[model samples]
Target: MSDARAQAPETEIVDRNLTLEIARITERAAIAAAGWRGKGDEMRADQAAVEAMHDALTRIDFKGKVVIGEMRGSEKLGLDEEVGTGRGPDIDVAVDPLEGVTGCAKDLPDALSVLAFAERGGLLHVPDAYMEKIAIGPGYPEGIVDLDKSPRENIETLAKAKGVPITEIVACVLDRPRHASLLAELREIGVAVKLLPDGDIAAVIHAANSDDTGIDIYMGSGGAPEGVLAAVAMRCIGGQMQGRLILDTAAKREQAERIGIPDLKAKYSAEDMAHGDVLFAATGVTKGSLLNGVKILPRKIVTSSVVMRSWSKTTRWITAEHQR
Candidate 1:
């Protein structure tokens, strides 16, 4: 099995704050996507975000390779595509231009624009596939949870580790049909399950930011690219996560093999997904837990964003008022 942790990033660059620049990118995307909110067009909203994010990224000076991006179908920012103006450090980029298309279209909560920056090979490049993920916030003993464990066991163990009852723990999960049995198991164990309509990346962040949200863990399957993006945030915000690609089909397995992931069943740690110096930025497209969505005013637009840097363990909440 190939480990992505080996090619970790070096010390931070002194030139500029990359996290803030990336925040602008997400801000642009969120603003663009917000224009279509509640218009009931998912693809149009996604396209608006993708185009704006691509334009913002290309205008930047860094040399970036899209390690994790919109898979096969999207017109821009596909895997392995080179971006930026090619004038600065060589880095890996992972992005989800619009995280919750459905939510955004319906004017629901937590629609976001997100991306991560890491050193070359600092991110695990996986094919477009579903990933089985398990995550928890910081301050826990290593190896306390595993993907192979049932929800009951994981929740009970986490509750005990925290010296609390199972009812006190809250686990976030996608409200999908596939999770029916898992939901039943969690309910039987008395752990509250927070059902998310979309945005598993936010779900992971919620789990990582347990002090504020009380989300003890996040489990279930989501996009492999989003898994990498979430892992980057964990590196900065402090968390533990594990993911395994669900390459059940022959085509998916072959694609994984082609991308150097020979061990189809190999479980990857958060560090394995993003091991080096990294930055993560996210801007809300709709009002949600982590941030307030873009607000359009008569004379300006306001955006709320969170930017994090791994080396310094700094997390900043930025609010920008752009003249209209």
Candidate 2:
């Protein structure tokens, strides 16, 4: 099989040992966000995480460029911000200092601090826009669920592929007004649906680990940056996914073009979004299915994080305690 990523220079590979460093960065971001959780202030919580992550990034050895980070106009981790000592291998990075801002602000579940590192030109440069996404765990035939297919068709196809009844297959979607019709169609098909208030990145990870998470599929629209991050994780963790940016407005289209995205209507596969070897790390700001929330103890803070490496096909869960 041909990989689109081969076109990019693959001469230098980011050292696999840096996975722990990446986990530390996310842990710092998560612990920082945890302080503001339930404070009912989204911006402050996100900014705190960004600052903490940025500070942690400076302590690392490798040079990194943010391909995806921060929302536009925030300057948090804006599209081209460079970090690190600029002494190690140059790499591409995608980060979400705080994924579930609203959830974190309200003390809800599933808020996470996530980041991915890849060899130079390894990850796609996605605009900060909405992306139509569909993903499913491994062990099924390729192309079981497609972004172009209707919800019912996707459900039926997946059911047939899994050799189960339609009602037995589970689907996860983001909860939003725009999904009103999508929700209706899924219910109309008699399939089980799990609606997440925020953090579709976790939902996508759950889908990729169906045997354990019990989420057979993930479908819906989410941030393009998170979509690319999820695709990078899927590369390391194992899954199939497809995404297409929702370039609805002129500003979005222009931004996409400015970022060298020539085909506005192109559908990107997991490998297309993040190709070759990559490492992904994510820490839980609030407890959820994927990881435990940051725990503030008497004189220390405990954090849980998961780091994955594509080259080795291994996942590492790290827990650290930091003194106050």
Candidate 3:
């Protein structure tokens, strides 16, 4: 099929404007983060990106609000103050100023600055708990597998259903101590496993767009903020994703209850979490698995990103040029 015919029709132009603004924010954050690469100061790098984004957001004339954001308390010294409230189009904001802090510190690939915008009360305000997640590229049947199954079993099932070998399926998981057993199981099953230090948003996007990236699935627990951001991108790309909250402690469970997450174990689909119109964008800060790090040239800097909206199933690979 022609790309145009396969693409979802663009319905709302307003989202395009929002996307442009978000792209600008991410671009600026990427530039600001470039200076902190290899400094062994992840917090400083993230703060610089956050400050740049805060400044860029203030310039935009949207009365949007933030439903999910970084923690604000004594722990953060120079974090941006909350500027959004429950007003205007009832929007929700999810941002990761620098998605891959360690990757940026090591100058690895796939260190991205990410953001997701949805209509008010759209994206789920999930707690900071582990989530058993399963995601695939677009046009796959829903409910093909569940997180309860063994990693090998799920891989075999998906391979049989998709009529491909288990070796062809690329699964991404964070390179953490918790993933050691899971990685071994995937290796035993002949599936290619991509271990990333951070930035599951890029991994999720890779799974949601199989035509460009060969990644067929993403299965693991990541940050709650990243789950929401990934859902926004999957919503735009017509992919399937399901996440169930995993709370490890009573304090975290209470925190979830406080945020009104009724069932911590409830399976949340992409739409269930990020409903209504959505605009998602991410620009690379340091090179990792999905994208390259921002490059500085004599005249300008170049960055790559993937932007999408629910109204359009096609994902745009944008290369932005910024003046030095």
lDDT of each: 0.90, 0.89, 0.77
Cα shift from native, residue 145, model 2 (Å): 1.2
Q: TM-score: which candidate is best?
A: 1
Better of 1 and 2 by lDDT: 1
Those runs of model 2 whose alpha carbons end farther than 4 Å from true positions after fitting are 1-16
lDDT of 2 at 178: 91
Model 1, 1-324: lDDT tens per residue? 135544554454335457678989999999999999999999999999999999999988888999898753778998888999998888899989999899999998889999899877799989989999999999999989999888788888898899999899999999899889989888887888999998999999999999999899999999998999999999999979999999989999999999999688999998999987888999999999889999999999999999998877789999999999
- Write down the RMSD of all candidates, one decimal each: 4.1, 3.3, 3.6
Instruction: In model 2, state the lDDT of residue 228.
Output: 93
Score every model by TM-score.
0.95, 0.95, 0.89
TM-score of 3: 0.89
Candidate 1 global lDDT? 0.90
Which candidate leads in lDDT? 1
**lDDT for model 2:** 0.89
- What's the ranking of the predictions by TM-score, best on top? 1, 2, 3
Tens-place lDDT digits, model 2, residues 169-245: 88899999998898898898888898888998898999999998888999889999999999988998888999999
Against the correct fold, how does model 1 do in TM-score?
0.95
